[model samples]
Every structure is written in C-alpha cells, then in structure tokens.
Target: MTEQRPTLADVARVAGVSRAAASRAINGTYGASEAVRRRVREVAAELGFEPHAVARALATGRGSAGRRERIEILIVDPDPEAMSAKPFYGRVLNGAMRALGDQDIALEVRRVSALPVDDTDPPFGRVLINVPGAAGAAYARRGRTVALGRSAPGVAFVAPDNDDGGRQAAVHLVATGRRRVGAVFGPATPCANERKAGFLRVMSGAGRAVASADGDFTRARAYMATRELLEREPDLDAVFASCDVTAMGVLRALRETGRRVADDVAVVGFDGSALAEAADLSSVYMPVEDEAESAIRCLLDPARPAPARLPTRLAVRGSS
Candidate 1:
C-alpha cells in the first residue's frame, strides 16, 4: 500500500502555526504574515506535503460541480499599463471577459515581466500574451499553457490571420488604383512581421515598389516613420499601416503634408478598431474576441485542436 500523504495539520504542527496559517501559506492566500508563510512552507516541504491541485481548486471555489477551472491570462509585459492602453489589447481582454461571463470558470489577469524560477506549481492554467523569446518558452514548459498570440516552438496559440490581412490590405489598395505605395510596419513581433511580409509579397507581385518604414506599433512612432516615408517618396499614392493605432499617425502625417485622403493618397490600416472607424480608415477586421475565446478553450482542454488562426476581412471605408 502507498504511504499516507502528509496532511495540512501535520505541516501546521511542524511549523508551530495554526492550521489556518498553513492553508494560507500553502495556497499563497492573503492574511498570512511573511514569516509565518515562510515557516509553514518550509515545514510542509520537509514533511513531503504536496497540495493537491483539485483540493486547492475546491477550496478556492473553482472546483464545484457544474463549475469549471480557474484560468489566468498572463500579459507578459513589463509595462502592463502601456500595453493595455492600446485599443487592440484592450479589445482582446474585453472579448475574453465576455466569453467568461457567467461561465463555470473563473478568470484572472496577471502581468509579469519575466517568468519565475521556482518549482512551485501555478494555481491555474495560463493564457500567455505578448511574451516573447525565452520567457515565452519557459511559460510554455508549464503544463496547460496557451498563448493569445503566436509563441515559441511547441506552444499552442490562437491569433488572427495577420498575413492574410496584410494581403487583403494590399489587394484593396491595388484594386483601388493606388500605386507608388508606402507602408508603415510595426515592431519585430510575429504578427507585425507576418503582416509586413504579406504586404511586401503582394506589392512586389504587383510590380509596385514599396517605400517602407518601421514603427513600434504606436501613433507617435508611426507618425515619425510616415514623415520619413513621405519625404522619401513624395508621390506615394497609398499607405498601409500594420495596425489601426499606427494608421492614426499615418493619417495625421498625410494631413500635415497637405495630402487629400483617397484622392491624393489612400490609407489602409489593420485591427479594424474604433479608431479606424472614427477616422474612416479602411482596415483589416480581425476577430479578436473569437481568438480570446478559443485561447481559453485551448487552455482548458489541451486535447482540443489548437494553435488556431482566425479569419480576417477588409472593412472598406472613406480612407481607402
């Protein structure tokens, strides 16, 4: 017969702490003083006590019948506030929250600059977003992890078809008879790089040379890049921005340069965000909400067909 597992009471006794304190420390719950927490954990480890995931979930009200598991949406950004300020990321969160509404599951949002180097198990599965390089890989190694965007090798993810969106943007401009095109591409992220690649592929296929500049997926950076592109190609008849926020800057720069929208230069953007709608900018409409929902599903059920890429469509407006 298997040896009986050490109980929370055993841990508490060994640490000379109350059972409540042991529970709090083991669960990383609030109200346990730092010294008590440390002592409890040490005693539990010494006793070979491992907190069962299901029991912990039940204690936290996340394992009741008809209720689903708790999950975390980890936004891997050092500056979470700045990241959330972007309309695209905000919409992703809104979509995730909507999908979670009144569901059997509980959701938590966390922002971390880097992955912790600890043997402790995470309380819940995680949906990683905006994490890149080795940090993303480290999180992927943890069980039951899914990504909100394309991630490192062997990681499951849900994201928009960014390359297709870029192609659609190019086709729209070309069909509208706009040549001498300029493009404002975003940073080195996978989505940004894919969009740029697709746009350039189509432009080259159409025998049109593209004047391109890089932006950090921000209005200010795009604004500066647009100025450079315009100066380099004065007769540029159209501009394709990697994302809607960057497009706002492109529009501003065009206006400052006394260029008329659609007549002098057509403008296209991505993300189909509210800003694009307000500016009447033609954009690629990606299903951000669907992506988020799918990500949650993937995390909950790893056996599900995963690494899904949602479709995109062109929303034509006055700008193009």
Candidate 2:
C-alpha cells in the first residue's frame, strides 16, 4: 500500500493547534496570531501536507480550482438600518452579483464597525467598501484585499471617477445658465471629498459663489442641510447633491420652500441610481457595476494590473 499522505489533521497535531487553526494559517486567514500562523505553516510544510485544490473543486462542483474560493465584500457601516435604506447599496449588490455571474466562488456582504479583532478563518479575499482608513489597514493585513470607492495606502482599489463627476455636474449647471448655486456635500469620506473638490474647483473657476453645507449622506440630514443652505442663500438657483438620496431631500426642501425644480432651482445629484431616474433628476452616472467587477478581478488575479479610474458621465433629465 502507498504511504498515507499527511493531512491537515496531522499538520494541526504536529503544530499543537486545532485543525481549524491549521486551515486558517494555511489559507492566510485571520484569527491565528502571526506566530501561530508561521508555526502552523512550518509544520504543514514539514509534514508535506498540501491542500488539494482539485478535490475541493470536485466537492464544490466549481469550474476550476479557483472557483471554490470565497470573497467577501465588507461594508464597514455601524448603522445597519441606515446602510440598507440607501438605494445605492442595492445597486452595488446588483452590480457585484452580475459581475460574479456563473462563478462558483461565494460572495458575501458583511457589516462591521471595525476589522475583526481575532484571526478567525479568513476568506480567499476581501473587498472593502465604505470602511475607514484605519479599518482598511487592519483588514488588508489579513490577506488579499481590495478597496471599493476609496483608496487605501498599500492596497488595491477601484473607485468611480468622483472628481470628474463633480466637474460634469458643475458644467451642466453652468451650461444651463444657472448661477448662485448651493451644494449638499456628503459625509467626509474620500469619495465625497473628491466630489466636493471637483465641484468646488469648477464653480470657483467659473467665478460663482457657492453656499455649501455638510450632510451625513442621509435624506433627513440632507433635508436639514438644504433648508440651511437656502436660508443662507435664498437666491440660489441651482443645487448639487453628493448623491441621489440626498438629492431627494433637496427636492423636498425646495418644494416646501415653494421652489420649482429646473425652473426655480436646477437640481443635480450623483450615483445615477434608480431614484435619480424616477425623480427625473440629472445626475453623474458612475459605472458602479464595472468597478465592482474590476475589484473582483483584482482580488482573483494577483498579477492583474491596477484598476483604472472608472469613467463618469452626466445623465441629463428633467430636473437639470
């Protein structure tokens, strides 16, 4: 009989750790301390215990050895309710799912306030979305990681062309003969910051004074901000919202103040979401789905080139 091949169990036994720990270490998963991971990997190598990709593929019915992999999309939002309430979340998931089409790899979304404190079994990779810079740094240490929407130091990322999107909105407003504009900028995330910068840059260049207010990227906050903006600049004839959801709030505020959209205040927003279409709001359309797809590709292929900045275009509608 052929000599028995050493299994993960044997590696775990020799490493004096649980099979799960051994697996996690071998897979470069979180949970295991660096010391433990190094020890387990050393033991695995000594025992000649190699993971069987072909067997895993057969068991999972995946097309290739890589198909059995699992990638997680981590949305670092503390408020689950508010995060889910946004239409952009669903749109992002839709794009991610479409990008994953027919792949045997599992894709999951997880919400967390911060990176996991313990090294649990890590997935094949992770896509970080809406995470803070510190949290992103922590998660990237675990394994292959890709950031969506914002770039982190020493990590791969895919993001929409936010600066250009902002420029597009400003150009549209200017072309439409609107002056005395106001802006409802989103939360202080990098994406939002870029959009704000782009819009402000163009507006400043055009020699237009813009009344601006900060919003938490929520409808209620935007509504309040819009009210304040109008109060500060009652003669404002155009408003640029950082996102479609915020744009909705802006619309409500305008209506309550008896300002007709387009005629009284040409409104523009970002994200090119369904809400924008339903409300006939002109928006900068970013290719979110393509970004998601590119993120996945980056995670799967380590050698894949850095993702380029996805393009954004203005979707003109009745609102602008």
Best by TM-score: 2
Give each model's whole-structure lDDT. Answer: 0.81, 0.84
Over 4 Å off in model 2, which ranges?
1-68, 113-116
Q: What are the runs in model 1 whose C-alpha is more than 4 Å off?
A: 1-70, 77-84, 112-121
- Among residues 3 or more apart in sequence or in different chains, the pairs in candidate 2 whose N, CA or C atoms overlap within 3 Å are 30-119, 30-120, 31-119, 31-120
- lDDT tens digits, residues 21-48, model 1? 6786787653366678788998888899
Q: Candidate 1, 103: how far from true, in Å? A: 3.8
Q: Indicate the residue-level lDDT of 71 in model 1.
A: 77
